[model samples]
Target: MNLLDVRKRSLGVSFNTEGQADIYVWSPIAKKVALVLPDKNKTISLAKEDMGYWHTSTTDIKPGDLYKIVLDDDLERPDPASLAQPEGVHGPSQAIDVNTFKWTDSNWNNIPLEDYILYELHTGTFTPEGTFASMEQKLDYLKELGVNAIEIMPVAQFPGSRNWGYDGVLPFATQNSYGGAEGLQHLVDACHQKGIAVILDVVYNHMGPEGNYLNDFGPYFTDKYNTPWGPALNFDDAGCDGVRKYFTENLLMWFRDFHIDAVRMDAVHAIKDFSATHILREMKMCVNELMQQTGRTHYMIVELDLNDTRFINPLEEQGFGMDAQWVDEFHHALRVTAGGDRNGYYSDFTGLQHLAKAYTDAYVYDGQYSPHRDKIFGIKAENNPGKQFIVFSQNHDQVGNRMLGERTSQLSSFEMQKLMAGAVMVSPFLPMLFMGEEYSEPNPFLYFVSHTDPELAEAVRKGRKAEFAAFHAQGEAPDPMAEDTFNESKLQWELLNQDPHQTMFRYYQTLIRLRKELPALRQLNRKQVEVVPNEEQQTLVLHRWHDNDHVVCVMNFSKTAQQVSLPSYSDSLTKVLDSAAPEWKGPAASPDQADSTSAVTVQPESIIIYTNHA
Candidate 1:
């Protein structure tokens, strides 16, 4: 059966042809199930059907009506497939007709994954209002910034307003605080109109601790394995079909109903499934079917720490057909090269050499022994295309998980921040910019949450403390439950009008424009790229070519200026951009031109770009 037909026949609330509410739920353990309408003070018993399913249709209920499911006339809970939770996670699920939204993106075909310049943002802290409406107001700003795609953090309904969004409980319900279901549709439709694609982050490995009633309905979790968050989802257990179907429906709901162009699955490595057909492969097959049926393109990107290329490999080769994945190795190596502390995971990376490896090969630990992991970790991704990996210098986890939550702007000098931006933009892999990285926003992206349960809140605080025990000498971690922590993480939008921030913003704009327009940089063919690392001088040179077009990027990570030899590919190379030039307020300007015969003096902690055509 098709995904829509399957959803309508066996899940929460779907309207029938006669305009009545058709309710279905899966509960093998419930001897009796009834629909309870608290507002109307009414009860309707559902008839038990095959395969642990219950069914009932009612003319009294309509869209916007709040209702709950009562199991065996005892425990009451929200619908597992709820489209809207107007109240909080603990409240009743509201019936929402997703087709009501008037979409204006009929001609909006999605951009190719190769052309994507993604900007990752947390909806809650991207703006002061922290709602879908507020986010829509900044589409023009993002468009001007040259990012064709925006990857929003998870919006699934959590316990309260303030959260990093990983604590989401209801996978189908939109966060009521963020304007709920209709609000998200409006934002997505607006984004499409501006020639931008929206990618939503989703978590399926584990549900949140509070208000998670999936176990009360059926065997949605398994004791066979555990996740850091909580009990692992029952993807391979006896009743695994119901659990798999539940998430498969959620995946389709975002693309089919909400019109999301892509989904960035959060932490697929944490999902434990020993089944012959892995859950990720199953989901990819379903997505392929949906894409064929709709005649539109959609993608599934994953946040995976495992350097396994099997996840992104083609399904015909007995692998999961994921379009792309975030590569954290690039971030670690780049940070260490920029003089970051060599502690924790940073200890595994040895500065310039590892960074150069990440440029050529997608994984720094590809089939190599890892001292930090105490064993050989990660298979080689040598055969994977460059577009299959996304690289970034700073992201939410890289910043927020720290004790101080210090951003690259807070840790490095102005020159170093610009160098990091150039490093990411010049790589062969797809590049992503965190919320305020373009303008060098000084505020920290700290971890924050607002759970109604005090014990759970305290537990989160203690967990943060324990996670950062290595940095105990720095200071006590901020209280995650405090409102101030969330407020402090908000992006300082006004900083763009200031000094170095304005210069940094212009630098990023130019870099993105160059990446889009330059033939050598725009092409993502890894075979045409060469990275030469000079460990002695703490510098690296990246050379890229497409057809006859050639460009070179030289990055100096040292504390002093270094004389670097130019490549012999072209007789004369013209300077395109200099991060150390007077326009960007650097210490001093470097030579504007260089050839194979003459060495160029590169400024300390800066990047200079040269092109053959110029």
Candidate 2:
């Protein structure tokens, strides 16, 4: 039975029957369980069951009742099934009637996976105000730029004022410093009011080093498995049923209670689950049930490093039901092409060939031998994937985790920078941009966290430096624990008026318009994308096809000027956007591309998109 459908809602209680009221509090560790209604001064001792679930049928307990679980008559705490945390995590759990909030999106439907253009932004760093309402102010800008969804970094409560938001300690509560819970609701309502979907990033594997008090209650973590963060959840151990409920409840809380449309589960591989039905599978099942309950289609995305296709594959085919995953192949290839650093995974990717292959095929090392890992990596996804695949040129991890926390534009030439923007928008995969990427804001996007403990802070500081040193020989690394790290990570919003920044901004907006308007560029559930390489030159041609119409993309990846010979096709090519063109004022100077130098005299770096005229 759905407990939410019951009439009366009280703290530290559950229904005895469909129509009867009963107060319940299970204290396995407590010698005696007492349900104290502080409002009425009514005290009732529950008869503890063999399973330790304390229960009592009391007619006095009614809806909107306020009570707390008295643990051995010493400490009282919020209910584990708290629907609302009006007073934050350490306060009372309000009994919220699920059907109370008046939702306005009755006929609203989310855009298909293939049709998504995501803009990933951290709420705290996006604006000076650093709240949900602050980002809400930019809805018109996103709509104008053609971004359909805003993928926000984790908003769950961590420690202190500023953070990356990934190491969320309280899974159910919104960050108090970032305008708290009511403010977040306002943001979601505002986003839906405008035509945008909101995707939240959630970490289920491990909690922050501090403020994570789940262990104080029971065996929420286990030593059987370990994660980089503090402890792996006890998903397979004894008394693990409640652990599963904790995560599943958090998932439903986001979608149903917070009105969040989608969630990006952080690090699925880190979750240690040996259950018959895995945690990921259970999550998908719970989400499916929520969809049936709410009559809304919500999406669950996985951020996996395993590079397994079973995530998006069908359940009958022995796959986890993930809507999509972040494809690092495309991101790595594009980064190396633009930044030209082969320190880490970039070692596997070098020239324009890999970049071309990545844009053409989503994976560059698909089941291929790898020298970096000394093992074969990635599966051959030559066949079609039903779920959508998300890709971005530069994201928080790529830019922030760097040895100096440098952005692409900080290192690449202006010409190359604009080409990167052009390349990102025209690509077939679902494109996402980290905040300030559109206007080329020079924010560092560095990794920042607030740990009050001195020892933990020092460990994080030393760990970050050592991690980078392991990958590269020598480089100036940012101080992970310094105040400057957070200060530098904030977006410099006024850069919109700058010359090259404005030009690139317009280029991004134009490409977004094209992605939304063009049918060929839209994501259709199939593998209809193709990449044609110029074997001898640093150029690649890409094509995305619909029924009869086709969208063509050409990329120039050299440091010097060169001629690129055009292919002889029946359809005349209409240049839709040219990064090296004068309107964008690109530095490229390719006079003609069809010459035998069969050459298109291309500048140092550029990308060109043209419409096919049949």
Candidate 3:
């Protein structure tokens, strides 16, 4: 079944069997709405319907037609739900037949959340060519790296060629620089063929400041609520059903037309909707219905800073019931434990105890008072499954948002990097790796944008500096408008063949493979894991087990070798993995010969793992 077969198509350009196009747009305040066909030099007036939707039918319009809407015949604007804005944000919208692209993977089923080892990459910076075709060429490499899913950063049509893609104005249009709609479809098809699921990042918080035409057409923005970008979207206000329907259909289009397996909703906390059912809940219900009809599993992963478990809780418990959400607490706890600078948000995460808490308890701030925000932060997420929280050591936001955009490879020693990698891959939560993190790519992922408006460009430069000022770094932020900054952020793929980089890359590969092979490690139960933190020695021990099978991880955060007392467990043990092993470019040490009462000597700032021998 296709997108049109599942549910009635909402606000967009849809074609019928006779090649006639039915144009439906919602503009309650506009006294007049007309479709202007530039190629044929014809105009068709749409009659206003009962609920503020303007309707018009025409047989002359077909796929690949270039058209625009005239509001009251006095002003012109592109469609808010445009599929292909080939001419950029200021140009005409292009018609597309969603059913044209043929998919080869008819038997593709969704990857279960427990099996996801996600790899996130920005489309423009992931490769030298930085297009969809270029991204497709690297699928073999990603598959070999043992990542089952690729979480692409937002690729919705934005202002110019270079952007993080959060500033997209036309939500439906694919960026022209990245090969447009056909390009995205090609990447999706290729991913499915390689047995990899694609998770697209989407921004629903606010529209970008540039080329925003939604407000001109109707009451899309509401002054009733304020957001960091602008006024909140009109979700519960008058004529908001149309606004909700526009975004809801957009979500379904990605799944139905593009065959996307999942989506990572960007900053869902900022989507303030006071309706009886929030927008996130509505999206869950809509995707559920779509899944039932098509027999294809579709899921939503949210990026929420609020640390509320309600987002992943079941709907019957008065929660939103999302599939998963990003857990920043894990990053904060792990980063600080690895001797990272304690500044800004990092100020709140202190001591090695937090790391142990993260392993046993789902969140460290479960109802605890936060000194950084001067209030209690987060609720207990213990009831939820471990896979509901996605954890990453290095990601786009963590790297790009930094003052120098330095990755973990730049901040810590090679052994410490291996320790961080071990913690991420071995934990019960879902794991994700930023591009080039497996090989320790040196190039920084700096923030960059290519806005045509000089004023907006200058504002962006100043805004980035002001935003990072609280960190009190020594140097100024990189200029967002500078082409050199964008060039510097691209990954150096050649480093994978070098000495230390190659060793680190192999270490990550081994860890991912072992995690998959070990049944005890694959389980996602918090109760099955035990955290024992020795604060005086600056070391932590995590014991994970399932079905009488057990694995223990001992980590040393201090600068000197320390003897870690093995936890009192009845199972016999043998060393399985070690960060300080000579093969991983670490100091050589013999394997531990110890019972439950004996202690094992660990190298400075390294991790060692042991599995049950019985």
Candidate 4:
């Protein structure tokens, strides 16, 4: 069946072409189901349909009406497929007609995945106001920064106002504090109008702990497997059909209703399904069909710990046809190269060589034995196109998961930050930037939440403390339940006007412009790139070519200056960019030219780029 048919057959309140509302809910176990309107003091009994579905059609209940579903005359709870949780997770769900909003993106076909320069931001911490409307004001700035897409963190309804959005319980509803359904639609419409695509982060492996009422209606989770959060969603177990349909319809809702260009599926490694046809494969097939019908490009980018090529392989090859995935190995290797502590997963990477491997091959471990994992991990993804892997030096998990939530700006020198940026920008893979990384926002991105239950809140606090036990020297992990922690994570926009921050911002803009304009940099072909690593000198040389255009980047991770021989792509090669240039506030004694005839002394912790055609 098509996506619209699936959404109609599944649970949730949907409107017909005539503006008539029809409510369909899956509750095989419940003997009776009734739609309860709390404000109207009315309860309407729903007729039971085939395959354990409860259905009702009504003109009396219109958009903006508050509602709850009662099963077997029990306590009233929000709908499992609520479109808007306007009054928090525990309160009644508000009915929303998605078609009411006027969209102006009729001519906006999404850009290709390879052309995407993604900027990921958390809604609560990106700005002081922390609303969707507030984010719309920053579209001009993002467009100026050369980012074609923005990936918003999860917005599903969770308990209270403050959260990282992973604790969301209502998968279908937009966060009420973020201006609900209308606000998100307006933001998306504005984004499309500005020629920027929107990618929404979504979690489907496991639901959050509190305010999760899916179990009360049906068996949405399974006892067969356990995820890092809790019990895994029932994808391959008994009564899995409803569970799969619910999530599939949720995907369609975001693409069709909200106009999201892509979805970054959170932690696909934690998703366990041993069925013949995996859940991911099924969802991709549905998405493929949807794309054919709509004539718009939509992508599924997964966050996976496993270095498996099967996820991104073609469907005809008996693999899940996902468009792309986030490669944490690239970040880990890049972080270690930039002098990050050798703790946790950072232990597996050994600076320059691993970073070089990440440039040529997407996965650094590529069938090698990892000391941190204590086993042989990952297969080679050398054949995969660079566009399939998204690389970033700093992301939410990399920065926030730290004990003090130290960003690269906090740990590394200014020169090192520029070096890292050049390394990522020069690579063949798609690059992403964190919210405030452009100007190096110094504020820590700490983990924070605002759960109503005191016991659950305390458990979250204790869990955060216990997570950092491996890094023994800390006084205490920041209290995740504290309002101050959330406040501290907000970006300092004023930093862009400051001295070094302004220089860094301009440097990033230049790099992005080069990445977009340079033919060698714009092409994301893995076969066209070559990496030469010097472990002795702690330096990496990357060479990329597209037809007659050639670009070479020299990166030095060492604390001391190093003499490097320049690659002779052509005699007419010109030095395009240098981190040590006087305008970048670098050391006075820096190499002025990169000539193939003689070795040049590169400044410590810096990068220089040379191109034949620029």
Candidate 5:
């Protein structure tokens, strides 16, 4: 999946300098294959090649030309490796020349995972226009907010327009509704120019239920294992080499072609790969080679329910070699402590001690009893640095999957919200902020999808309601097929300039700045961090330091004012940042000053940060 491997392949339509193109496709079941060039109004029968691959070279094809492949001279299908599906999934495929577009980010070096301050956003709902170009305009604002990287939800082509992008069918093509491939490249270029790395969330577990034509081409799916979305992909089954190559090439395309700094593989636990070399390991080796050649740091983060460190451990240690994985244990514990709605998975987490456990260890349920699942869950994430886990109080799944799609800002009090923010930013693990979290945007992130098929749309609606039945929310879930639902998810950008919203925004800005300015706060080593929680007082003190430098974050999870004591340390602790300060629109109840040996009175459900200054 490197440039050399890409140059050797004839798959898709690769245009050359002589105005000629080489097209290659692998369809084992087909007896006849013909290149149908609608732009030239001609059809050329392709010659059969080795390994069920059909190939044809001709000068008739050009960039932006519409084409399809004819099977047995009767049925025509879009290219399985289509670069641009601007005219929807069922429409004719458009040939796009990726090399033609000039890139301005040749000198861009990607930010490492250790320094990552990720802001997760959905392209369609991030801005009012809901396009990549509109997202490009907001790069400066994100830069000012101190976010070093942006983790975008999938942009791969899905059915109709309004989706979470999880149901993407076309791996190569960017979502046409989000400005297609060129727009994505432009957005990536703009982000790189402003020192912001782009981490794309990709769905490799299963394709969407609609517009999935891979089965028509070959055995891209298998009946061996069933997935939540559909049949599992053919990773270790027959004809899996080609399927693995297809996905591996797609990963390289994002990194090499689109200049994406990283990729967050969605729901990796669902991808059942039993091969000797797992698909993730293959991807890791491929990405590592690309990094060595390009001298750019590219990360491969995965979303897995399993808290196994093998995913992020070193390859020499017989591991998968993934850069990092999403940690949901912290979010669940924080949600339960902050008085948020606890249902289903939230039932397993309780009390302020759970939060402390998540801080000391990456997961609270590491090989522990889980009442929710009625069994033991998760393995110890040993030998892995805390940076290998991405922690957040709220994400797309935690918010949009709810019946009301209420965010943490809506679920908890203003002081509780500040406390959660303090815990996430100062924690040892990497931090991710959901879109509009900085300003606490009032709008909800409803689950919306615009499917052309009515039957499928109705099924999705019913499924969503059934998923949230256990939460026992007040009213019925919003209709996923409603255009209003998608519209309601858009961020209210103007609120950042308003009264309380502006204060919340400043609070986040200050926290991010402090996280970056302090060297002791940047380390992700759990051994360097200490967490002490008082069950009776419901207060948690997170202390992270290196050598003589120390930063302590004291959080009161109680609903009323309380005096939280601190044990004496090597140096006196002075107040550095207080979430209850008058400037941050708090109750202005913070103590005047503090020493490590004394106690400080904290307002209801607030956070106070102190540092040991020599």
Candidate 6:
């Protein structure tokens, strides 16, 4: 058999000379592997030794070549690293040179974390057209709405045209429904051109339960521990080096090859790796090194529920060294203030103190004793010193977990909703928004999947029911695979013209602009936060402050209007944002010019942002 040529400028595979291919695949089931080039080029096959290392190459294969492999003549498969999967998941792989895709973002410095008012959006549901090209048209509008970064849900190839994308099985292949990798590239290019950063939400902890063929390759996963989806990855096992590299390399690819500015590592705490050092740490160092080389500030952020501060601290200091972590405290506090209900994890956060803690400390549970977890959960985020925690009043999980998938908007009045938006944007920690939240789009962001396997599809539907039933909160979970779920999730573009929706959008935009312009609000110092908690009044106020140049953040959580007297301000200040001033009053509201500080009455369901005018 003639040997097929394999060479890459990438870190993974390389074959420098003809007839000497350095071929590597994860396939373990195959006893013999042969690389087959089309057009009767030759019967060149690679030699195999030391666990799936198929080598030996010839000049038969060249750039722009199409190829498939005879896996022990048992199964014919496509190249794992195929740059183009024109034939879909079950078809032949098209090899293309990565160097040829012209990048227009040579000068793109990543948007900083502090600057990111993240918009977490699901692509397939983001627009009626449901394509990246269609989505690109809306970039200007999002830009106008003050979205600096777009945190897109996962886009790797899954089974069908519709999915929330967590069901992705082919990590290398972009979902065909979204116009594949090219479509994503167009979106990235458009975002870069518009000075908007793109952060992909990647799931590497566990593969989707269906259409997963990694096990056919080798011990990609082990039964040592089980994830809700499937088996956990075998990161520490003997043959796990390549597996770890595969995942890490893919992450770097998102930054390097695709020009993605950042990655929102999904549920990183679920990523169990017990190497001498942590895999996450290694991944961070690797990406940071790449950023240094490219002169860009690509970041690795994580979504960890572990409440472990170590995830955000430096490696030497014994933390995970992530650029940032989502502070659930912010979400919890905001939820309690807006919704006034405590169940599930919300059980830990009840009343105004929790909301105040979230306002002051960024994490409501920071260093607090918790009855929910039984043991103490974490140290105050202030201990981290100089970092920004991401806060959101409503995110995908909180809304979708409901049996009815009702939005926070559904549970509150127009005034209350506006007030919640104010509390979210004006806080010390950096802020984020779920898509459709700013406009208060009256649509539900439910979990949706399109699995080809009927049995697998049924399981997803049933699992949704069971999970929500355990909560015992609401009945009738949205069928993620249903056409209605996808249809219902799309933003009602018409809502922008509605009074309350338009008002809220403008209000949100104002808060974001103020956040950018305010010197005091720009401070990422978690330690500098001060909370004045009022349990009896159900009022929580905090100062995300610079003493000499001060800013005051006040929140009112009651359903009805209540006037409260507060202590005088430290410095002469003007009211910068009143969430209840009809609409879009951020930066426009002025404190009564009588005194710099005084006992003032706050209306019910209002948030006041006072900025020093001195």
Error of 6 at 103 (Å): 1.4
Worst 10 residues of 5 by lDDT: 1-10
Each model's lDDT comes to 0.91, 0.72, 0.87, 0.89, 0.86, 0.72
Candidate 1 Cα misplacement greater than 4 A, ranges: 1-10, 16-18
Task: Show model 3 residue runs off by greater than 4 Å.
Answer: 1-8, 469-473
Clash pairs, candidate 1, are none
In order of lDDT, best first, we have 1, 4, 3, 5, 6, 2
Candidate that scores best on lDDT: 1
lDDT of 4: 0.89
How well is each residue in 1-614 modelled by candidate 4, as lDDT tens digits? 11235233246787777878889888878999999988898887899887678898887677889999999998688999999987799999988888778988999999989999999999999999999999999999999999999999999999999999999999999999988989999999999999999999999988888899999888899999888898999998988777888898899889878889999999998888888999999999888877777887899999999999999898998889889999999999998888888887899989888898899889998899999999999998866788999999999999998889888899888999999988888889999999999898899999999999999999999898888877668678999999999999999998898989999999999999999999999999899888888988998889899999888888889999999877765455677889988889988444545557877677899988888865
Model 1, span 1-614: residue lDDT tens: 12334233347887766778888888988999998889999888899887778888888788888999999989999988888888788899998778778998989999999999999999999999999999999999999999999999999999999998998889989999999989999999999999999999999988988889998999999999989987899999988887888898889889988899999999999999889999999999888888888887899999998999889999999889999999999999999999998998999999999999999998999888999999999998878988899999999999998888899999999999999999999999899999999999999999899999989988889998998887778888999999999999999899999988999999999999989988899999999988889999999999999998889999999999999988886458989999999899898887777887888999999999998887
Please list all clashing residue pairs in model 5, or write none if there are none. Answer: none
Q: Per-residue CA lDDT of candidate 6, range 382-429, in tens?
A: 565434478887888777766676787887777677778777777777
lDDT of 1 at 58: 84
The segments of candidate 5 whose C-alpha lies over 4 angstroms from its true place after superposition are: 1-10, 469-473
lDDT-best of 2 and 5: 5
Q: Which ranges of candidate 4 are over 4 A from the true structure?
A: 1-10, 470-472, 589-593
- Compose the digit string of candidate 5's lDDT tens values, residues 1-614: 11227323346887877768888887877899988888688887888877777888888888989988888888888888888887888888898877777899989988878999999999999999999999999999999889999999999888999999998888888999899989999999999899999999999999998888888778898999999887999999988877888888888888888889999999999998999999999888988887888788899999988877778787888899998989998999998898875777888988688899999888898898889999888787766887899999899999998788888878887878888999899998899999999988889999999888889998999998887776664778889999999999999998988878899988999999988877778877789888889888888888889778888888988877788777577677778788888888788757656776667888778899888762
Question: What is residue 66's positional error in candidate 1, in angstroms?
Answer: 0.8
TM-score of each: 0.98, 0.87, 0.97, 0.98, 0.97, 0.91
lDDT of 2: 0.72
The lowest-lDDT stretch of 10 consecutive residues in candidate 6 is: 1-10
lDDT of 3 at 9: 55
